[model samples]
Target: MTSRFERGVTYAILALFTVTSLTPVLGILSTAFGRQSSLDTGFSLPDGLNWGNFADAWSRAHFGTYLMNSVLVTAAVVTATCVLAVLAAYAFAVMRFPGSTVLFYLFLAGLTLPQEALIVPLYFDLRHWGLTDTYWALILPQTAQSLAFAVFWMRAYFRGSPRAVIEAARIDGASSWTTLWRILVPMGRPAISTMVVIVFMWTWNEFLLALVMVSDEAHRTVPLGLAFFQGQHSSDTVLLAAASVLIALPVVIVYVLLQRRFIEGMLSGATKE
Candidate 1:
């Protein structure tokens, strides 16, 4: 059992880390709400809540179009990645066939390759294929990129699943597809939810991929839009802060909604192999 002194130290350390992490966010919030004229007062609370900052930022930045593009791209990437990863992971975990080990290792190789290394060739390939400046440019590449980690994550969970449960399902004369979809998938809700949150955040915040793959304004994601917005409004701290908040709000909302499952998945040993 943990000692009282040890528990107290742990809580104190966690509290310090929490405040450290939140300090920058609080500073941004203060600047977002502060009067435009008070830009010189660094990190101080606003005299009054300036709600119009968000409205003005939204209008000036054209976030609606960018946000919608991000939503479409993120949703597509997450859905595709999850479906493909689950199928691939289930096969690796439960099925055996010729060259399965080699194939699985090849998938794991993707995790070692960084996006920067492939961006140039990938751009040329996408351009050659006439996919540049399109949603497919964003969605397809990101889905493929995310699949590496997604497969790795879900495979561990599937491998750690109870053997008795899998045997019982097999004894029921269930097909592999039925066992995966009905029994394993439902049982791994926490792990899947955790993967969703991670992949959503990654896809939503992806900037370099968007920049290299897409040049059309219609295909720009939030991070790309925010970069241009920042360039144009470099001096407008209030609007910048507000726009930053807007860009981050969706990710924050998603994590908040899935916080419990994410934590549960992380803390649980079900992913151990």
Candidate 2:
């Protein structure tokens, strides 16, 4: 029932957005490849593809260490958030227990509290426990920050799942654990994949928490490392662009790998039955 004109309009809008987004990325790439002496900035083609800039940035900035730290922290935060969110969401969506509503609402309350409001107290508590300057300092706080949204996301998916299917699982004498892992979890792949992608990006890009929690250079995440790198190489646009690309590459790769599932999940509304 859609008219051709509307479809054309939609495609035109999408194309415009695509170009707008890609322009900055293309500009960075151009600058990243430019000669060290060249002063060209945004959107200008490089004199040549100077691949050495990447090598220089990687070595001089010690991006390898920072990248590894980010990987560890992001992986831990995503895994913990997803696993805990799934369990908590399942319980909230399916299980009836005392104070379930109150408990779920409390979890939801976490979504309302900004990280800035909690970071100071959180840093003190972690320091008191001797967790500062460690992976736990990054992983624990990001995991907690991500949990509220994760729980909310998964709970909607679980709650909207067909009641008849759940009843059939129960009729087959399947335990709740078995039903969740063997049945619902498999069916929820798209939703879970979406959550994984989102949490991974958030944790990978987190700066303030990393800055406030960890002071050791060994524990600096990519964003924090990039900030310091920027300070030192403020005038070296080529090197700076290269470092920015390095920091952003993993996120791009992850999204590309999961693009199909991500699109499916987005299109299939979170609360769709």
Candidate 3:
């Protein structure tokens, strides 16, 4: 009974904290639906609806092009990174081979390197290869950067997965590819969904790669485009909020949709066999 009481108290505290955290986000959401003058006094509900704010911001910021570029780059990075990371992580977690530990550690070492440290060299390397100002520039670097963490994330889950189940799949005549895709992949959803959410969020919000590697306005991702948008609409708080909401909506939506898997992945380590 005491433990149950304690659990109830804990949940109440967490619920309060969640509401507190979301207050700022709710404020910004309300701002997105109002006018610039609405903010001068304090936070409040829009007198009515102001859908034009979104239209104006979208039109003025040329967010259509920016959104397209973001979608393309993020989609490429997420797909390539997931495929490569899952393959590499499965080998690390399941296979026995020469120097696996060393290779794994080398991949892990990439986690320590900062993007700022690599940008200058990366810029030069891309320029030398004439890949600068191209979608490949954004796609490739983000994919590479994301792969390190994705491998790490997937490796933990894969290592914890049921060894008996894996053996059964192999004994049932499943090839390596068949076993991985047909058996282990379905069981690893929580981890995969978590990785997808993280990679999508990171790739969507990435600024430095877009700023340095993409020169053309047509190639600008939403975040970089938002920077220019902010510069132009510095005084229009309503428009800025709306623009931010538009840029951020996809990430929020993705998280909301995959939230169950994300939470499960986070809590999945303790029951490992």
The Cα RMSD in angstroms, rounded to one decimal, for candidate 2 relative to the true structure is 1.1
Candidate 3 colliding pairs, count: 0
Location of the lowest summed lDDT over 10 successive residues in candidate 1: 264-273
Worst 10 residues of 3 by lDDT: 34-43
- What TM-score should be assigned to candidate 3? 0.93
Q: How many clashes show up per model? A: 0, 0, 0
Q: Estimate, for each residue in 1-273, the C-alpha lDDT of model 3 and write its tens digit.
A: 479889999999999999999888888778888865665422688886789989999999999999999999999999999999999999999988999999999999989999999999999999999999999999999999999999998888788889998899889988889888998888888889889999999999999999999989989999999999889888888999899989999998999999998888778741245
What lDDT does each candidate get?
0.92, 0.92, 0.90
Show pairs that collide, candidate 3: none
Give the Cα error of residue 176 in candidate 2, in Å. 0.3
Query: Which clashing pairs does model 1 show?
Result: none
lDDT for residue 221 in candidate 2, whole number 0-100: 89
Query: lDDT by residue for model 1 over 1-273, one digit each (tens)?
Result: 999999999999999999999999999999999887776445787999999999999999899999999999999999999999999999999999899899899999999999999999999999999999999999999999999999989999999998888899999999999999998998898899999999999999999999998888888889999999999999999999999999999999999999998988888843633
